[model samples]
Target: MIRVVVADDQALIRTGFITILDSQDDLEVVGEAGDGKSAVEVAQRLRPDVIVMDVRMPVMDGIEATRRLAGAGVPDPLKVLVVTTFNLDEYVYEALRAGAAGFLLKDASPQQLIAGVRTVARGESLLAPEVTRRLIGRYAARLRPADPAVTAESALTPRELEVLRLIAAGQSNAEIAATLVIGAETVKTYVSRILTKLNLRDRVQAVVYAYRTGLVSPND
Candidate 1:
């Protein structure tokens, strides 16, 4: 079973999410929290496979909670799936930067929510291509300027660089394979290598890294 913790300030919302997630055969709501601080506490103690976090809460807020649970330098970082009522660019950007494995609008359907949890639980990003382009592109200019010392060329081979670009562009392995005229397994290998070389956690971080390093741009 994929254990999950649902965190939200609203009791109704928390119960609703718990109900839906528990309904899934593969998912179980092991814990629930009403505020960001409690969410962090419960998650740290329980160490669920996935956390369904709310962006705005009374005590800390989901972004900070995510950072506490999954931020860089965290040993054995947990996978976080941020759920927010707002689709604002800043929230999405900050959540991803805080090491959330996925972001989903609260307005998303139950199936979408379930799928988001499963996607994060499986160690994959839940960002759809259009959503990624729209959210990350809008915030591209706000990202810190690329560090001159860390260039993609220095870390990745020519083909690996190409794969990273496609990944940042929000292409799936199958899509990338088709785009590069390569096999899916080859693309997967390239992705694994890119992550290892860059010391990135997953595709979401890779996208952030690509933008932070000026590798793949909003215009690209």
Candidate 2:
């Protein structure tokens, strides 16, 4: 079973998420928290497979909580799925940078929510293609130009470089396969190799890395 902790400041929202998650045979709501701090505490203690976090909560925000639990340099990072009513670009971008494995709008369908949790639990990121492009593109534009020598080209082969660029462009494995005229399995292998070579946690980080390294740009 995929253990989950639903964290939200509102009781109704928390119960609603718990109900939907518990309905799934493969998922279980092992814990729930009404605030960000409590969410962090319960998550650390329970070490659930996924935590459904709310962005805006008292005591501490979900972004900070995610950073604490799953951010960079942590000895052991937990998977976080951030759910927010606000679909604002800043919130989504910050959540991803804070180490959330997935970001879902609270208005997303129940099926989408369930799938988001499962995806994150399986160690994959759940970013919508359009959202990934818009949010990452918007934020990446503010970054300073990447160092001339620091790039994926040095570490990745030509094929891997192509795959990385497509990934940064928010293309799924199937999309990439079609675009590159390759098999889906081949695309998956390339993605896996890219992550391994780049030492990235998932596709989300790969997108960030690609942008940060100037492997791809917002215009691309």
Candidate 3:
């Protein structure tokens, strides 16, 4: 089963999420928290597979909590899926930068929410194409380039670099294969190699890395 912890300041929303998630045979709501601090504590103690986190909370916010659990230097980082009713660009970008595996609007369908949990549990991100482009575009415009020493550009072959750019552009494996006129399995191999070379945890980080390196611009 996929263990989940729901963290939201609002009781109704929190309970509602629990109901929807627990109804699934493959999912279980193991814990709930009304604030970010407790959320972190519950997560650390329970070690749930995925956390469904809300942005605004008492004491600490979801962004900081996510950073604590999944940020750059942390070992054995937990997977976080940030959910909010607000469409604020800064919130989305900050949550991603803080190492959230995915982002979802609270207004998302129940199916979408459940699918998102499964996706994150399987080590995949859930960035909506349009929202991802806009948020990453803003991030690229505001933040400085990532450190030169950490860049793995030279580690990738030209084909791998092209695949990375397409990934940063939000293309899926099948789409990339179709675009490149290659087999889907070959595309998957390239993706795996790219992640290995870049040392990215997942495609979400790959997107951020691409933007941070200025390898793919917002307009691209």
Candidate 4:
């Protein structure tokens, strides 16, 4: 089963997510927290597979909580899914930078929510390429990348670079296979190599790395 922890200041919202997630045979609500601080605490204790976090909460916001749970220095980071009633680009950008596996609008359908959790649990990112690009276009200027000089050319083979570009473009493994005239497993291998070379945790981080390093730009 995929263990999930729900964190929201609103009782109704928290309960609603718990109900929706728990009804799935493959999913279970391991814990719930009413604020960001509590969310962090519960996550540390439960070590859930996915965390459904609210962006704005008292004591700490979801962004900071995500950083604490899944940030750069974390040894065993948990996957986080930032959920909000608002679609503020800044929130989405910060959440991703803070190591969230994806962003979900609270009004997203119940099925979407379930899918988001499953996506994150399976170690896949939930953010679409277009959404990631748009959010980065709006907020990337506010944050400095850890390394501005890093380039895929220096580290990856030409074919691997192409695969990274397709991933940054938001193409799925199947789509990338079709585009590159390769097998799906070959595309997966390229993706794995790209991640290893980049020292990225997952495709979501790879997407962020691509944008931050100008491998794929906002205009592209």
Candidate 5:
């Protein structure tokens, strides 16, 4: 079972989430907190696999709580998925920077909420929202491009680069194979190589790096 702890300033919201999550056979609501301070404490005590975090808590807030939890090195650190009603928030990006697994709108469908938990619990990030992906592209434009000099010219062969570009365009491996007229397994191989060379955690990070490195432009 995936252990979950909900942290939100609203008592009703916490109760609502706990009820929703506990309904799932595969998930258990181990604890709940009305503030970030108690959140950190309960999470450390229960060692939940996932934390349904809310951004605007009474103290510390979600971003700081995530940073502190990660930095303090909780023995079995929880994967925080920020749940908020607002789609656009100043704190969202900072929360991600502080190592939140992902963010979800509070009104997300039950399937999406459950999927968010499973994705983070499995050590994978949820797919980047299209708006958030574009946000990252704009964020990348602020920095000078990475050294533009790569040692291994053949590290990602021309074909592999094509595959990487498709991934940056948000194409799944199966989708890329269909578009490129290649086998899915071959596409997966190319993806693995791209990640190995780039040292990214997952495809979402790869897409970010692709834009940052100019491998794929914002228009592309």
Candidate 6:
């Protein structure tokens, strides 16, 4: 079963999520928290496979909670899915930077929300090109990248760079395989190598890297 913890300040929202998740035989609502602090505590105690965290809470917002949990490195690398009321790019970027596995809009359909949890639970990230570009405009506009152009010469092999570009473009493993004329497993391997080479937390961060490095730009 995919154990999950729902963290939201609102009791109704938390209960709704619990109901939806619990109905799925594959998912379980292991715990719930009213704030980020409690979120961290419940996550530690339950060691859930996925955590649905609300961005705005009374004490210790989701961002800090995610950061703290990441810093703790507890529960064998928890997968945090930031569920926010706002679609502000900054929130998404900050959540990803804080080691969250993915970003999900609060208004997303119940199926989408459940899918997001399942996606991250499988150790994969869910991010699209639009999401990546918007986050760049929101959080990366002021930041400076070490290099404007991160070429294959830097560290990534040509094949790996191709994979990174596709990832940045929001292509799935199957799509990437079709594009590169390789097996999906090969693309998965390339993705793993790319993350390791770039010292990134996940593909979502890799998309950020592409934007920051100008390998893929806001306009592109």
Q: What are the RMSDs of all candidates, in order?
A: 1.6, 1.8, 1.5, 2.0, 3.7, 3.0
Candidate 6 residue 76 Cα shift, in angstroms, is: 3.7
Query: Residue 8's C-alpha lDDT in candidate 5?
Result: 93
Over 3-83, each residue of candidate 2 has an lDDT whose tens digit, in order, gives 999999999999999999999999999999988999999999999999999999999999999999999997799999988
lDDT score, candidate 3: 0.89
The best candidate by lDDT is 3
User: Candidates 3 and 6: which is better by TM-score?
Assistant: 3
Off by over 4 Å in 4: 148-150
lDDT of 3 by residue, 112-163 (tens): 9999999999998887776676677766667888875556568988999999
- What TM-score goes with each of the models? 0.93, 0.93, 0.94, 0.90, 0.75, 0.84
lDDT per residue for candidate 4 within 77-127, as digits (tens), equals 999999965456678777888999888887889999999999999988887
Evaluate residue 144 in candidate 3 and report its C-alpha lDDT on the 0 to 100 scale: 85
Between candidates 3 and 4, name the one with more favorable TM-score. Answer: 3
Model 4 C-alpha lDDT versus the unseen true structure: 0.86
Lowest lDDT sum, 10 consecutive residues, model 3, at: 84-93
Q: In each prediction, how many residue pairs overlap at the backbone (N, C-alpha, C within less than 3 A)?
A: 0, 0, 0, 0, 0, 0
Order the numbered candidates by lDDT, best leading: 3, 1, 2, 4, 6, 5
In order, the Cα lDDT scores of the candidates are 0.88, 0.87, 0.89, 0.86, 0.74, 0.80
Off by over 4 Å in 5: 70-77, 85-90, 128-134, 138-155, 211-219
